[model samples]
Target chain A: MTLEEVRHLLDAEVLSGHEYMKKEVSKAFSCDLMSDALTSVEDRTLLLTGLVNPHTVRTAEMLDISGVVFVRGKVPDEDTIKLAKENGIVIMITKYTLYVSSGILYSNGLEGASILHN
Target chain B: MITIKLKYQVEKDDFMKAGQASSNLKKVLKQLGINSKIVRKIAIATYEAEMNIIIHSEGGSIDASIDPEKVKIIVRDRGPGIKDIELAMKAGYSTASQKVRELGFGAGMGLPNIKRCCDEFAIRSSFGEYTELSITIYHSGNNTEEGGE
Candidate 1:
């Protein structure tokens, strides 16, 4: 699914990388723990996280993840937003919780990123 | 043989600048025309090592030596080192503080993730003095197969 559709599905607000709304990201990973999230190797996966911090963006940057959705109405501080912009990662905010956001995206035909652990 | 050497200082508890070293190293590898898959592997391993220093040690440095065939990342830190290497290597084991956990790390996956990403991984620690990690990833051939064009 394109990030634009994700935005529409969740009524999310794009805080950065507005131009990337059309970027297709069919796989998503939802996690607050950066290390667990890093276990996945999928590229172009959208991260749905409640952790709003610079490390989140750093994790995405290292893994080549292109987009992040902040769940549970979480909003990142200025530094986090700046880092995401610097790394060219699109950031969005959604009022839904992480589970709901994941469910919404999953039911909409988006798949979960394949994880390395059992 | 052409080689590129890069060094970066990692400060303790410096959450704001924690990823700078790995980020710079990743850029340099990309500019050097390393394969994207290999670069991704190097970036993830280096970043985890860099973050481990920031979140766990007093301070440290990460050194990268890149040649045509492989890249080697050496991470060394002043410590308060790990007392139990076996337990520390466990995937869900972490000694990070609550504050660190709140930062979205500390799920204890750093070292394991690094090992998983690299072709060769070695670690040494002096318990009270310091810890060091050597990570290597090949660009093409396996570890045993060596030749030159």
Candidate 2:
């Protein structure tokens, strides 16, 4: 689904990068840990998490993630949102928990990249 | 035909600025007309490693360079050298503190991720001295039949 569809489905508010709503996204990965996403996330994936930090945007930049969804109503500070805007990563704030968020996206056809094991 | 030297001082315990070094490198690569996909791979791999150094070491430094042929990133830290390189290289081994883990790092895959992305990778460390990692990825090898590209 595209960013617009995800926003509508989750009833989320676009906290930043509304321009990126037209972008297409295929897979979704939910993790509170930045390292796992760093190791495993792949092309055009959507990252669902509760952590609020600039590293989140950095993570999307490195992995080329489609966008970032802040689950459980977590809202990042100004710096974090500003960085996301600069990096051009689509960002949204949703009230759903990580599990619920992941399920909604998954049921809607988003996928995780192949499990990369050591 | 040119070489650029860049340095980043990863401030200790500054989780907010974790990937600045790698991001700057990515910016430079993009301006140089490096392929977007390849730059993404390099950015992720190097940034992960850079974060590890800052959170694990006592504020380390990264020295990076680039040229027409490829991009190179060298991350050096004076933290206690990995007590066990083999275990550390494991996907699940991490020495990062609880706080670091809370930021989503210390999964023990930093070294492996760096190795996976670059065409040439090297790591050297001394117990009391420091740990230095050298990574080189030829632009051509980036997209070859090598999986991602």
| Leading candidate by lDDT | 1
Number of the top TM-score candidate:
1
Q: What fraction of the genuine interface contacts, i.e. the true contacts, does candidate 1 reproduce? A: 0.74
After best superposition, candidate 1 residue B86: deviation in angstroms? 1.0
- lDDT by residue (tens digit), candidate 1, B1-149: 48989999999999889889999998887777666767778988998898899999999999999887889989999989889998999999999999999988899998988899998999999999999999999985432312210
True lDDT of residue A109, candidate 2: 86
Itemize residue pairs with steric clashes in candidate 2.
A34-B104, A35-B104
What are the TM-scores, per candidate, against the unseen true structure?
0.94, 0.91
* Model 2 CA lDDT for position A55: 78
> What ranges in model 1 sit over 4 Å off?
B141-149
- Writing each residue's lDDT as its tens digit, candidate 2 over B38-128 gives 7877887789778877877777888878776887888888767776677777777777788777777777778888888777888888776
